[model samples]
Target: MESKELINKSAKKIWQKWSIAIRITPLIILLALLKILTHYLGWEVLELNALFTSLVAGTIFLIGFLISGVLSDYKESEKLPSEISASMKSLVDDTYTIYKTKNTLTALEFIEFQKMFCNSLINWFYKKEKTKVILKKISEMNHFFIELDKEGVQAGYIIKMKNEQNNLRKMILRIDTIRDTNFVDSAYTILEAMGFLIGCCLLIIKIEPFYASLFFTLVVTFLIAYMFLLIKDLDNPFDYSSNGESGTEVSLKPIHDLRKLLIDFI
Candidate 1:
């Protein structure tokens, strides 16, 4: 089978990812131009060196903190799909064992359950289905494991199967939590507020020549606004539909491979 390309985020595609952030460019430029105009009109520009410096310093630190926090979760999310695939593989092996142990019909029924469970995951990861929808399916898979108990399968195999089932449920819910939540809601609020203030500062502060002010204002504002959008895009690794930077998302190939493996069983 052909490999799916993800890491080859060409410069053009990378620029496209900036599209969301670029929407604010016109406004940032307007602010810079507006600042330049104030100089031409001979209006007094506020030159608070310490205040401007402190604000930029504080905001930069805050952005750094947010990036560090969000990255940990994003890294964790990347591993979950592969781990989940492994758990399902183990679970399928247990179910197959039951089939050979003379509970053939019942075991095959459970195999059907496995297929549905895996398919639902692909949909859920795509955001086509909500958390509760997937939770209900997971609950059903759990109960199916219980049915195997009466088949007189060895206690050890049953326990192992149940454990694998638990692992699957745990990882899916983990992904759901990451998808539905933010790294820190209040932190994001603060970042946006600070971003607005910095934009205002860039427009109102006194800098050197008109050209210098224009250069600093445009460059600084663009970096701040771009990172704000990029951080938000990174915070939700499962947001596959976003136009944000490519390859930021956790790859789904493991899940797809698991789906293919399940289909082979059916």
Candidate 2:
């Protein structure tokens, strides 16, 4: 078990490193490809006018812009999980406060419900499966609040708790939508095509130093692949796994901390 844990930890570290590297891999690849093209053109091995240089530079600029857009999308994606976590933590705290003040449910019952709701939430965040189960659990929580409302709990407190629950549900739904959405698909397709075109351009160059051309081509290819993998991995930050393990995921530390707080409250 220890060995397995160690391997999992190592794999997570590697994934994190690769994830960071992939963000810039496309630009690096493009520069390297351009450098090779420039060298061959300068050596007169590949006959092309200044027009070709301008075109290559333009293409690099365009691709760099696309990468920037992708990075923007990635940053947006990173915010969502934290948003959900915050909403959840607030909901948990608010629920506990309501329970304490209203006395609609016994401590044991509130704890039991809290445990079930929180467990379902964490599972939903991590497993991202069993939506029916999560929805059902949420319905149960909502129903519990409704029951409290009927039992002479202050309408204001009940309304606040319900609103928190609704916000939590909406955030969860947003997360699910994000998980299903493909933010980077179009960007990736464009990048892949550009990479292919670049590769073709490289192949056409009649450089005498065939090995150098070949080396540069390989590097560009690898870099393009790296970019694709990186974008895909980052597109849905919640869904990626390197070794089919869970720890490489976006940190659920906020939720975990909330869980501890819930335990303390109980």
The lDDT leader among the candidates is 1
Q: What is the lDDT of residue 62 in candidate 2?
A: 55
Q: How does each model score on lDDT?
A: 0.78, 0.64
lDDT per residue, candidate 1, 128-241, as tens digits? 778788877877875666666666667798788778878877888888788789989999899899888887777777777768877887888888887787788779988865
Expressed as tens digits, the lDDT of each residue in 1-266 for candidate 2 is: 99999998898777676754655666566756675666667642454457555655655665666566657656666676667667666666666676677664643475577666776677776674476677776777766766666777667766776777787677677767766777656666776677667656665665556677667556655655565565565556566333232423456666666677777666
Ten-residue stretch with the least lDDT total in model 1 = 1-10
Error of 2 at 255 (Å): 2.1
lDDT of 1: 0.78
Residue pairs whose backbone atoms clash in candidate 2: none
lDDT for 185 in candidate 1 is 94
Please give the lDDT score at residue 144 for candidate 2: 70
